[model samples]
Target: MTDVAPARPGPAPRVVLVPGFWLGAWAWDDVAPHLAAAGLDPVALTLPGLEPDHPDRGSVTLEDQVCAIEDALTGGADGVATVLVAHSGAAAAATVALDRHVDEVAHVVWVDTAPASDGFVMNPDVEGPEYPLAVQWDEEMAQGSMRGLTDEQLAAFRQRAVPQPAASLRDRVALTSPRRLDVPSTIVCTAFPAAEYRSYAEQGVPFLAGLLEYRALELVDLPTGHWPMWSEPERLAAVIADRVPRGAR
Candidate 1:
């Protein structure tokens, strides 16, 4: 006589990759295959106005971005959790979405960004529908690190970058549930160190303030530029895969 275990149900946890301002799902091309190779399903999303030459760019709001993520979480098979990987500015919308659909998400990975709390507006400085990529790039260079990118990579980034929707930046983040804090989360520190991230959270930095109250949070230091997918795809993929539960992987 032999005893066998019953088969597990549903699909493995899906990895949903959301890019930040001025970018599209194409931005994740370098990282997706690596995640797939690690036995994980990776889905990169291009939010409403991020598509090149998108006709309705003028009207896309932050709420729309949140909805896009909600749709992704719901579109999957039942009982299959999702690993929502949000990068840079996309963290705002991802924060709200995670709060709304906590049970549907297995884990959240904030790469080079932090979870914004309720009423957090991305950028109030911009007054129009589109924030030019070049202008944004200049600001990023002045205020942030671009350490790991090569000249060719920078060229490709400039060539493909699209205008970010100012409305998305202007609309405030709306959070209703506190349960999201209980969802397992990881902060992948690339442009900065984990210690700095902790300090920022402790100091009540608006974008990272809620982290202080998270029930299951882990900080990991990758030590690269902000856009690790472009600079260190394989390494970033490995870090993300390591977060997934072993059964799902």
Candidate 2:
């Protein structure tokens, strides 16, 4: 009998879900079950300062958040890469972490957000130790739409919201690796269409600038609100499941 060749290793069948400011892993509850059903393990993360109850505020820096993400990206079984899913404000820290661990990530799915350019500060208005969610929500709405969220969903969001560390927002991004752009990336445009994001990228928007350099980047239009995990979770889950590396699936 001819000897059989061993199967090549694939990425870990895991997806790390990181939510934006003022939210925790609980924000992904609606979408996690569906991902699990699709044969992907979902590890939802609550960054250092956003944990339930008042954790240390004002003290958690952007580096702290980056470390948290790096921790999640490591220790996969069989030394396989992982898929990272970052939503809203979490994308800033995720971008820096991705830059450092580009080889460890199979793909990055930025939900209604984009990788931040180096030196980008997440929130310029944070003056106190803890930045409240209300103020940030208003500013976010002014910048984009929260179109599909219902009153009940909005109330629940408010109830579950926590104060984000001022330092995390104030700290600037420090990306040194140009190789991170080689990793595959997908931007799921929710509040706005892919066309709009492309337009911004063409016009040289600071936040969208990194998208231009990504060697493998895709933009998917999901058509909901910025917080699609809450408003269109099933569809969002489906979109993410489709991007899981085929071997992992």
CA lDDT, every model vs. true structure: 0.84, 0.85
lDDT of 2 at 222: 89
Overall local distance difference test of candidate 1 = 0.84
Task: Show model 1 residue runs off by greater than 4 Å.
Answer: 1-10, 135-144
**Model 2: lDDT to the true structure:** 0.85
lDDT of 2 by residue, 150-220 (tens): 87888888888998899988888999999998898999998889998989988988778777778899999
In candidate 2, which residue ranges exceed 4 Å CA deviation? 1-12, 135-144
lDDT of 1 by residue, 1-249 (tens): 111223246565689999998999999999998777666778899999888979978899888889999999878888666799999999999998999998899889999998888788877788877987763356566345676788798888888999998998888888999999989999999888999999988887887876787889999998888899998898888888877765664
Q: What's the C-alpha lDDT at position 99 in model 2?
A: 94
| Prediction RMSDs, each to the true structure | 4.7, 5.4
Tell me the TM-score of model 2: 0.90
